[model samples]
Target: MNTQPDAPRHVVATSADADTVLRRLAREGWTARSGFALPDPAWDVAAHRIVLHGRIADDDTETVALAVLAAARGAGVVAVCDPESAAGRALIDDLSRIGAVHRGTDGADPVASLIPEQRALLDRLAAGDTIAAAAAAEFLSLRTANRRIAEARALFGVRTTREAVLAYLRQRQPE
Candidate 1:
């Protein structure tokens, strides 16, 4: 899990609401905590880079949630929402309405743009014709896709070359 130095700060109307958001986040691999001191007095929950005001539960809910989403966007934190919430549903709708395209063939964020170099590397890997070379490229990177490739290779017991890793990824991909 990517541990931010602090939880992104977000405002929620009540402590209960904050807890709800934090609990949901925990389910999705984000850790949350309260009672931290911030430059602003009303900033209660720090969940990534989001500062939340923890007092008004009536009107501030959506604002805080949106702020949290914005912070996630800014911080490169992929905010997975609880599917049960109206807010989550609305966010999903908004993403689709905007023609957002998600590609996770490399275990990277679907919302993020692929770096040109990485895209080139992924193309080779996906083709499976140059597996050894692609795996070599991923091995030298510090990015998460590289880490996932390494982890997937380890899980599949691939140590030979990128070709071997590509085969593993192909076998694992759904038919």
Candidate 2:
């Protein structure tokens, strides 16, 4: 037997009704003393491991979950729900797209690996520059700017440039 001490586990219950989800987690052996209720006053990203459960919908929820996952660093983060449910599947798809939880591919931090030029482009966009204006600032052709934005979107698994920028910023926030 390996005999290594088991790692600490952090759990977050996400649902329209957080209380209900939390209660369910409690029944599954996740006590408040052992885990945490997300969005609660005690919640912190520095926990050793995190397990998010319940339903996730809308951009706000996704954003928060992403932030938490980013804060967890390389520690394990698991989302539990009935995969057959539409909402659950959507959450899984979103998580997979963003590379939040491993799904065969290495879960690398997309924002951290951004090249200098890409970082500059993202900075300009965040500072309220239009794609054309940002490109002009960098002396890049409009086509090149568009390509860069597209690349960012693909890298972050976001559909729009705005979403990519927001995701990057959210991930960059301190825990």
| lDDT minimum window of 10 residues, candidate 1 | 97-106
Give a tens-digit lDDT track for model 2, residues 1-118: 4242222222223333344444544565443322213454443433433344333343435533553454333222333334345544454444433333321112246664354456
Off by over 4 Å in 1: 1-124, 128-171
Instruction: Name the best candidate (by lDDT).
Output: 2
Q: What lDDT does candidate 1 reach at residue 122?
A: 51
RMSD of each: 11.2, 14.3
**On a 0 to 1 TM-score scale, where does candidate 2 land against the true structure?**
0.39
Off by over 4 Å in 2: 1-107, 173-175
TM-score for all models, in order of appearance: 0.25, 0.39
What would you estimate as the lDDT of candidate 2? 0.51
What would the per-residue lDDT of candidate 1 be over residues 30-108, giving only the tens digit for each residue?
6442322233334333344433223322333463355344443432123333323555344333332222212222223
**Top candidate, metric TM-score:** 2
Q: What is the C-alpha lDDT of each candidate?
A: 0.39, 0.51
